[model samples]
Target chain A: MIKFEVDNVSVEAKEGDTILGALRRNGVNVPTLCHMEDLAPTGACRICVVEVDGMRGLVPACSYPVAEGMKIKSRSPRVIEARRTVTQLLLANHPDDCLYCSRSGNCELQTIATELGVRQRLYRGQRATRKLDVSSPSVVRDPEKCILCGRCVRMCEEVQGVSAIDFIGRGSSTVIGTAFDRGLNVSSCINCGQCIVVCPTGALTERSHVDEVIAALADPDKYVVVQHAPAISVTIAEEFGVKPGTDADGRLVAALRRAGFDKVFDTSFSADLTIMEEGSELISRIRNNGVLPMITSCSPGWIKYVETFYPQLLPNVSTCKSPQQMLGALIKSFFAQTQGIAPEKIVSVSIMPCTAKKFEAQRPEFAPNGLPDVDYVLTTREAARLLRTCGINMERLEPDNADTPFGERSSAGKIFGAGGGVMEAAIRSAHFLLTGKELSEPKLTALRGTKDRKEMQLDIDGLKVGVAVVSGLGNARTLMNEIAAGRSDIHFIEVMACPGGCVGGGGQPIGLDRESVKERMKTLYNIDRDDALRVSHKNANVQRLYREFLGEPLGHRSHELLHTHYGKRDVLR
Target chain B: MTTTVDSILAEYAGAGRDALIPILQRVQEREGYLSTDAIVRIGEKLDLPAAKIYGVATFYNQFRFQPRGKNHIMICRGTACHVKGSAKVLENISHRTGVEPGRTSRDGQFSIEVVACMGACALAPAVNVNGHFYPKVSPTKVDRLIQDCRDEETN
Candidate 1:
């Protein structure tokens, strides 16, 4: 540890800690806009500038290393003035439409400005008019509101390993853009909205479908049904000032019903269905000498990443659709049939913790006979807004159960919200399919947590099976390269594009730190631990659906409704 | 054309990202501008994303993304030239050529660009066309310059 004097208060921090890190550790609040935890500091924003005892000018605390005996005044008058000037400059070029911005109440810039006492615009200048890019089905880019913090760029390039956007041009003309300043739809974007979560300003957001959903809800001709992802119920509580990871599942269903949905269902039920098909597919591949090391296709962003970067591995991906689409397809096929409603008149809406599900729902394969399976998708944030718009406080609502038929799900399905969850769920069912028995302890402790990559070898009925789970596309890319290089130890792989899987997905509540995501994951695991039905195959409703509609797992009807294939996609490099 | 990029990339075989600038420079030099195909090929060879490659290439003003026209006109916009009314000279040249700065004409015959400096401060309001410098250029002289280029093309 090294000793430093911050505001004349002695503090000790680890040896290589930056001034910002040390000050933060010492309970000193230093505001920063361009700083991201666990990322290499760029020191682009000078908001964290502080007065060092011997420095000629105020130095940025984010990138400056803490030295022994160094005296730092983090809130000195000069430092405050520099920070105010930086905020003023950022606001000078920023748009004045915060009232209409999607991030009005939650914008970091507005909060920082209010904290710095920047009541009025001190320096007004011509705001550069930048084009609004709304080409992608998932994300929206309002460049006029961007402050050039480069957080989105770094998150895309460094964290996600998808350099779909970057700082184009230089000087005052610099803007974050895709290749050739083209639309993001044509770029190498995997539609993982990680960039949206990191943007400090209102520059990046998920493309909203709330208005369309409201229109559908009001239409008497349409039978609008809604399903919420497992991660949504856990994280949506944060938007309502509840503690993070609080399971508001029943409250969320009640809230959706209050919002005028004809019926509310759970995506976890379809997640159980996914495990049934995906697990059976894994065993068939193992028994029939099919594609070894078959990768999971639950995350649409990972599927798109493979389609764009590693097209040769398309055949290796499991043919099962994601839970969101699986439920959508079932809603139109089986649910509509059971209700005696025309498929065209049924509007399927999904509330997801993912932005890629919006893109996934719009894929051509998901649409049949010129009719889309899922009509609209709302992020957890958007769902909160929708509920608020309807004057329904989600926290105060009475807990209610989801509709019958497609509402019952096993705890194994509920755990699909976390990273390595699908693998655990699949292993449970795959073990049952292979050896006609369940694991003595169903909880695979090795396949839990938010680690980048996890591996486990299991002997199921004397068959040695290797399984791997990875979240974050960068880690996925590394493992993929190893597999491509003929490392064939693994028989099955599960990959989620976001870091911690659906709980840390791109379209969850904004401004969430890693701790909140971990809490949400813990909540999912807690749900699994407390629940009775823990295996997907044991879910009575799913088994009934297989008997009533679909013949069996990997059957022709399942192939038609619950499974899909991927092909090579050409994108701007 | 793709074969040319492939051959150029062959010289940098077994190289890494350190060879990016040199590869881009060579490709741009050979193609007169960096095409999308060339950039994508370079990205593949360097094992880098094309967006990042484009980002790096665009930071410096040495790269162009479009094919050069037959008559490439560069107008100096340095401090010395600006004080001597190079902006009017640039406008007059753009008017005569019917092309915006840093863009090719519709007919692919003329292109215009505003450069920072050519190091000929003594001759203010300078214009260079097709590697030939015209010192102390006026807005009216832009007409004659276009005519001379047209005549040279005919010859």
Candidate 2:
């Protein structure tokens, strides 16, 4: 660690850490736009300028490293003026319509501007002209609101391992876009929505489902059943002024009830069912030589990445709908039959942390019973907005339980929100089914952490079970490359497109600091540990669903409702 | 200066022709200029052996691959750029050519590139066409004077 005195403040930080890192660690609020803690600093925004004692000019805290015993003035007059000037120059070219912008209350620029106390731009004239591109089903791109920090470009290239978008043209005319300015749907974009999450303004946002959700709630004929993803429960608490990683599961159920949801269910229950189907498929593939390296198809972002970038690997993906879709299918068919409600009156709404789920729910194959199984998908942020609009103070509300059949889930299902949870959940059940001998230690500790790639070789009864789990599209690329190169020998693999899995999804709360999200991940794992029903196969609700609705894991009913197929991309070709 | 240029060029050569992206970036970074001859020599060293390098250089707007003036200015013309008053800034810089983004100026005093989305949306109608990041850029503030490669001032 390196210790330094900055303007009479004693601060200590690890070696190789930037001045910004040190200052942020000390709770010094130095504003920034282009810089994120997890990303490399390009020093493009010029917002975090700080005055150094002996230095000639204001230096950007983000890129500059602190030397031993460096004296720094963080809130000096010159530094403040420099920051204001930079923001002014940025605002000169930025849109003045913040009131109507989707990011109005939550915009980083707006927050910084208010913090800096600047009301208006000194210079103004004709802005640049370019039409907004809203062609993609999942994301909306408004170039006019863009600040050109290259966060989306960096996310696409460095994080997603997909260089689908880039900065094209030179000064003043420079813009971030797909090659030849093609619409995003035409590009190799995986619709992961990481770009949308990283955007500091309204440049990119999820295609709004507010009106559709409201309409569904208003229709008295419809029985609107809402299912909450495991990750959303942990993150929705932040919107209610609660600390990060607080599991507001009970409050979430109550809020959905207030939002006019006829029945509030937990997708974790369906997640348990997904494990039964996917786990059975894995064992079958291993025994029948069905396919090697059978990949998990839970994350739609990862699924699309496979379609666009690794189409040749399609045969390896699991043939099960994500837990969200599986629940939607069950709600419309099995739950409808059980409740004695007409299938047509069922309006299935899913609140997920995943932005890609928006597109995944709309796929043609998702409609199993001649109707869209999942009628509406709201992001975690949207769910928070709904709660706030309904005057539901989530923090004050008493914790309530989820509805029957769909509400009952296991620790295995709860863990699915984190990176290696799916692999751990699958192995627990697979070991039980294959060996007829339950695991002595239910926690598959090897497949239950935040590492990018985790691999374990377990002895299940007499046979060896080798498995791998990976998160983030970039990490998935590295894993897939290993498999393609004949370097991997794992039997089963779980992949999530975003780092830290669904809890760190692109549709979660905006301005999500990495440290805060990591804490939430720990909470999710704790939720897994604290529950009595630890395994998916052991969940009473899953057992009941299979017995009453679907006869068996790979039965005809299961195949018709839960199974799916993959094909190569026609656009990339 | 020669050592600085040589070492930077050597880094690009080690990366190969696919290194064209980083090479063009280095040339722009080192000399603060991208001469056509520099592009040709870099292409020859990388063994591309085709106009592919030059085509790529012109294809994406960021690659200058040509010598430019001391001051490089960029004005954003993205959707936010339109909404943020980036056109007036463009008009002010229109007095120069060849270095005016797609085309920089005839004189070696300035060069420009208009980019799409710089991800600084809250400060939209932004411009980094040059190496400088002008958040809320305005047209009236376009007039400027001379400078050499000495400033090294970012943003």
Candidate 3:
């Protein structure tokens, strides 16, 4: 431990700790804009500058190492002045449209400016007019509002391992953009929304479909139906000032109904359907000597990543569509048939904890006869906003159940919100398909946490099966490389593009830290622990759906509606 | 005849990212500019993203994204030249050719660029076209230079 004096208070900090880390540990609050946890500090923003005892000028606390006997004044007058100046300079070039910005209430820059008492613009200069990039169906880029914090750039290149955007050009002309300053749609972007999650300003946001959804809701001829992902119910509570991980599932359904959806469905029911199809596919591949080590295709971002980077492994990915798309297809075909409504008149809308689902819903494969299966997608944040726009407070609503036929889901489907939940769910069903009996203890504790990667080997009916679950595209890339190099121990793999799976997705509530994501995962596990129906194969509604409409898993009707394939996609690097 | 991006990349076989600059330079030398296709090929060879490679390439002003025109024009905006009204000469050339500095004309016949210094401060305002320098250049001289290049193209 190193002893230091912060604000005249004696403190002890761990050796090799940065001054910012030590000060934060000591309960000293020093504001920072460009600093991200677990990332190498760039010290680009001098907002965390402190008045060190021996330093010639104020030093940035984010990168400066804590030294023994070092004296620092984090909130001294000189330090405050320096921070104010830096904030003023950033604000000088920023747009004055915060009232109209998507991040109006939650922007870090506005909060920091308010804290620093920057009431008025101190320095005004000619603002550089930058073009807005809205080519991607999922994410939008407003370069005029960007403060050049480089958080989105680092989050894209370092954390996600998809360098679709970077700092282009030099000095004052530098702006974060895709290759050749082209549209992000043509770039190597997986549309994970991780970049939008890390951006401090209103520079990055999901392409909103709330207006069109409202328009659909008002149309008397359109039978607008809505489905909410499993992760949405857990994380949407945070947007309403409720504690993180609070299961507002029933309340969310009630609120959606209040917001004028003709029918509200649960995507978890389709997730159970995914497990049935994907698990049967896995068992068949094992029995028939098909593609070994078949990877899951639940995450759209991971699908695009594979399509762009590792096109050779396209055949290895499971042919099952994601829960969002699966439910959309079912809503148009089965649900519409059951209701005696025309498929074209039924508008399928999904509320997801993802931005990539927007891109996934728009894929040409998901559209049949040039008619899209899913009409609109709203992120959890956007859903919260829409509910608020309709004067529907989740806290005040009574708990309500989802509509019948596609609402009932097993706990195994509910756990699909977390990273390794899919693998555990699939293993339970795959074991049943192979041995015709449920496991003694269905809870695979090995695959139940928020770790980046988890693997387990199981002996199911004397067949040794190896399984691995990985979240975040970077870790997926590493495991993929190993698999490509002929490491063939694993028989099935589950990959989610966002770290900690959809609970930590790019389209979840913004400004969420790792702790919130862990809490959401814990809530999903808690739901699974307490629920009665824990296996996807035992879901009565899913079995009834097969008997009523689809013949069986991977059957002709199922293949037409619930399964899809991916091909090589050419992108800008 | 110019070499292909594949042949140039093959010469740097078994090399890492440290060979990026040299590979880009070689491709630029052969192709007259760093085309998007060339950048993508280099990224595939070096195991880097095209955006990162483009970022690095853009940091240095030597890399050009557009192909050079038939008549390449470099106008000096050095300390001495700016004082001698090179800005007006630049404005005149841009007005005549409809090409901004660091951009090529639509017809692919003329390109304009502004350099910091050519170390010829003694000439004050100077313009260099196709490796030939015209010292103490005025607006009228720029017009005449454009006409001479056009006349040469007709010939």
Model 3, residue B91: displacement in angstroms?
A: 3.1
lDDT of 1 by residue, A1-573 (tens): 899898888989899999999999889889999999889999998899999998898999999999999999988889999999999999888889999998998899999999999999999877889999999999999999998899998988888899999999899989999988999999999999999999998899999999999899999998999999989999998998888889999989999999999999999999999999999999999999999899999999999999999999998999999999999999998888889999999999999989999999999999998789998999998999899888998877899999988899999999999999999999999999888988789999899997889999999978999999999999999999999999999999999999999999999998878899899999999999999999999999999998989999999999999999899999976
lDDT of 2 by residue, A1-573 (tens): 787877698888888888898888898888999996577799999999998888898899999997777888998788888888878877887888998898998898888888998787776745898888888878889988898888887887788787667776557866777744668788777788889889999999997786788888999988898999989898888876778989989988987887799999999998999999999999999899898889999999899888877899999999999999999888888889888999889888999998889889988888755688998888998888877777777777788999998898898899899888888889889988898877788887777667778889988867777888888898899899999999656888899998879888988888776776787888988988788888889898788877877999999999988888978874431
lDDT of predicted model 3:
0.93
Q: Write down the worst ten-residue block by lDDT for model 1 chain B.
A: B99-108
TM-scores of the candidates are 0.98, 0.80, 0.98
DockQ of every candidate: 0.80, 0.05, 0.84
- Point out where model 2 deviates above 4 Å: A1-3, B1-155
CA RMSD per model (angstroms):
1.5, 11.2, 1.3
TM-score: which is higher, 1 or 2?
Answer: 1
Best by lDDT: 3
Worst 10 residues of 1 chain A by lDDT: A388-397
The DockQ-based order of candidates, best leading, equals 3, 1, 2
Candidate 3 chain A weakest ten by summed lDDT: A152-161
Candidate 3 local lDDT, A336-441, one digit each (tens): 8888999999999999999999999999999999889998999999999898888898998899999988899999999999999999999999999999999999
Model 3 ranges with Cα > 4 A deviation: none
The true-versus-predicted C-alpha distance at residue A101 of model 3, in Å, is 0.5
- Comparison by DockQ, 2 against 3, better one: 3
